[model samples]
Target: MKPITALFAATLLASATAAVADDNLEKLGQFKTTGASPEIPTIPQTGPKADAIKKTLAKIKLPSGFKISLYALVPDARHMAVGPQGVVTFVGTRKNKVYAVTDRAKSGVADDVKPFASTIDLSIPNGPCFSKDGFLYIVEQNRVLVYPAAEFFYESPDVVAVPIVPKGELIPKDEESYNHTARVCRVGPDDKLYITLGQPFNVPAPEKLELYKKWGIGGIIRMDRDGKNREVFVNGIRNSVGMDFNPKDKSLWFTDNQVDGMGDKIPPGELNRATEAGQNFGFPWYGGGKVRTNEYKSETPPANVVFPQVEMDAHAADLGMVFYTGKKFPKKYQGAIFSAQHGSWNRTDPVGARVMVTYLKEDGTADKTETFAEGWLTSDGEYLGRPVDVAMLRDGSLLVSDDFAGALYRISYEGH
Candidate 1:
């Protein structure tokens, strides 16, 4: 929230100039000093994998006038960022790759899917978002990288990438773990980078609570575009993988996955709203909603702990979300919130793996929650696909990324 530091401003200027001066730098994929580039492979778009995803689409149910189809085949697709020019959609994965899905023909389906900046080694790059002016920021497990004009330079193997938060600086290296390390980010209306940092524990140790609180683990942090004036915007989140700013109010809204190990139906998932900075969404103290976790049941919670605007079904593992700002959707869905439920991992009976819609009241609070699209869970308790993120294309169509099936599904309104 403070002014951008002078050092960061200088670095930003230097990076900006270097990113645009493409001719001066001799590069090979990730190696700017060498001429040898790594072999970049493209994801197969037509094959058994695509066929399987298309077959599963038959079971998906949507409201009248809505239809769903296969968009792209991206392995381990966890999150998405639609290019400002609408030429490509950069999909991030939990593994080591970020894919670029292009609809060059202007067709509904993607014409090509390949690794974006394949030379760069990315670790747990689960979040990729673009600023309005076309800067692409990819949030990895322990670092953050920005690609100036990424949509334009992504076709080349050696796209210009500058690190905003270098390795081990996003979080303590000792605290890094595979669990809860998939981060999601959004460039807020204030032009700041907002990122979620999930604590790497089912329930954080009491001694680590203050440490986590201080570094924004299990919470969201915001900084200037150049990675300056970084501060904890909100704390006390269990692990939120999805968030978006409300177009009408510019307030931040996100989904939080609640604690596990409680009974299947006890602690509910969360869809929270933060109207201002420095707010706390109860985590260790209260798992979700008013349900208190055993770890902090004896201790008192912080004052003014903001509760969720909507308490979702427990263990749904709600992930990426987006506000319906497109004109293609019906009037009732104009300002609604659409989010993905990654489904329950260890529940008695599998639940979720569907898309949900939350309609907001006039005052910007949640009015009701409803199932927007479903059928990923079969009658035999099998998951056809687990939806992880939801993004909007320029045409007002919705793109849902399923990590389970390694595909992206497109939802559009065609009318009855």
Candidate 2:
């Protein structure tokens, strides 16, 4: 062979090999770097302790005509997604398991709680969302998977999950971290899948800001369910574990956990509204709303940075949220937003550990914020149950998942 032709052939071979290696890494995920695949531990199926649940229920405080009851005993429940049929409620966890809380009796309460996708291995499988057409989407630490006919097929032992975003492609391998690893997903009315990517750092270094922006980390990204045409929907958010679309205006709303270590009450948690794409909610620059952090004090934030609609109490780790669209609740709560304050861990006096309601004005702007439910945090700074997510059942009742108590509670209302 001629010398030039031989050289060209060698270069082509090397290029092909590199492409193949990249493909393998994408398919294998973090196991490529760690050399060991993490296994999902076998979780025992057990109901919540009846006496303990009764004690917790007695401690719960709700508005007049409202009552809270044990719905299921799902361990490590973080985020929840109710199926279209309302027969199955999917619960996600920060751990390796996802649970299906089934209401077999068609009653408001769930009768059975079982592990979902038990055959497939997962990492930080904390976000479970459903499309209007009944597709169940699960977002893990590094990938997205969808289960078709999920409500029906969940009963089977081996349900196949179709990969929408292949493993290791959601975020760069170097950016992954154990902290803020939990992701939340929602299907918008525009027929797109939205996923939140919380940057690993509490206050990211200035040097890493551009890369985080380019990769859509520390913000919400939206794409087709097939994982194409992805774009950052909101930016400059610091670890938002929950989000939901307003049924009225179809705008995206989310709960963001602000910066810590700047004293307990300096920067508050945020409930923000994103009216359009490409909106930047001030993050490292302004930790919550207007409170600037020391790390980014030297840098100037974007001129048009958006602020939160409601600034919640500091250290109140806000998580999953949903707009109240059910009819069972009174007319007052028709368009209100219900979000879970997972409670704070960094304060001398613990706060939150309750469900909060944010009322909206006629113009679709936030009007006022109030505590919808409390009693999770004891007087002595101990938490009986930490609410992680708030989901609505078909009967207009709300289901609150508690990771601390390893159970789900249903809050319903009867006329006074």
Candidate 3:
């Protein structure tokens, strides 16, 4: 072959190698496959009907000096994360989409609700959390993705999703189930990303215990923002859909939904606290708190199993929770935990469907649990709305996301 022909062949080989490298990088960077951008879904622009919403609001009971108002309409709003600037609030869902509730005028209420990152293929994208530096992290059923400057780029249709944890990495693909699939995420005080992966069974089979423990199922897992240094933070939780780090002690606190087969009054739901790593909260063995599960009643339980800080009503379906550090509410509300009980489906009489406040002592332990807001569940056993997650705006007011009503609400305090 001629020298020119040989040189051309070498150049072609170099180009091919570079192309392969670029493809690899794209695959590793995004959660989805390359060249597979899906059409963005159309989000509903309208909110709930005024008369119906007002009627439901009238039924709600709150402590004196507090008021609740509809903030925005977000479909399937499961968990929420407020942006650093308090401009955009990202809402996630068990469905395949996320939303952005924008407060453009710096008002407490949102001006617009729009679909966010609709191009990405999200599986049970229910947890949205933001870092102090403006990076948004989302926890899907089997992976976690990060969006840098998400608040600014959220409006752009071309915003990219960087996969911190690749697909099928959080759990085995075959083990995934619709039940307990929605994972909640939070950026802890130490700047690590923490996520809860609920075990997919009502009670995990005995044979699967080793695999579940190895994968950190039924527990909380933490990792660096880049998805490195992953480890289980806590174990033995049944299905915790909400978690937040205490602003005072930086200890991790969460809400765990108890087993269902037991009577409605037994195996109460839990508001748990983890002060140290590797703590086990007692699941399968003890359904919630100290209630021994029938499946594990005969087996020897693990020693040093941690109990809940507060035992909520059984079948309350406790989901999202946050530690109140804002000043908008009364001074007494500071350091309190505001949680959303999404309500139960299996009980003879449904409970929850309301917001709960767990007042905490100075030492960061729960003092007492009380209903902060109720009336979503009517006396006749109808649900007008089911609160899923609780979030706080910069002005110190609270935002509650209700998936049943497909709406978000704001709670503020005005002394009489």
After superposition, which runs of candidate 1 have C-alpha atoms over 4 Å from their true positions?
Answer: 1-34, 37-39
Ranking by TM-score: 1, 3, 2
lDDT of each: 0.91, 0.88, 0.86
Each candidate structure's TM-score, on Cα atoms with residue i matched to residue i, is: 0.92, 0.89, 0.90
Among residues 3 or more apart in sequence or in different chains, the pairs in candidate 3 whose N, CA or C atoms overlap within 3 Å are none
Measured by lDDT, the strongest candidate is 1
What are the RMSD figures for all models against the true structure?
A: 8.5, 8.7, 8.5
Cα error, residue 382 of model 1, in Å, equals: 0.2
Using lDDT as the measure, name the better of candidate 2 and candidate 3: 2
Cα lDDT of candidate 1 equals 0.91
Residue pairs clashing in model 2 are none
TM-score of 3: 0.90
Q: How many steric overlaps does candidate 2 have?
A: 0
lDDT of 1 by residue, 285-337 (tens): 99899999998999999999999999999999999999999999999999999
Instruction: By lDDT, rank the candidates, best first.
Output: 1, 2, 3
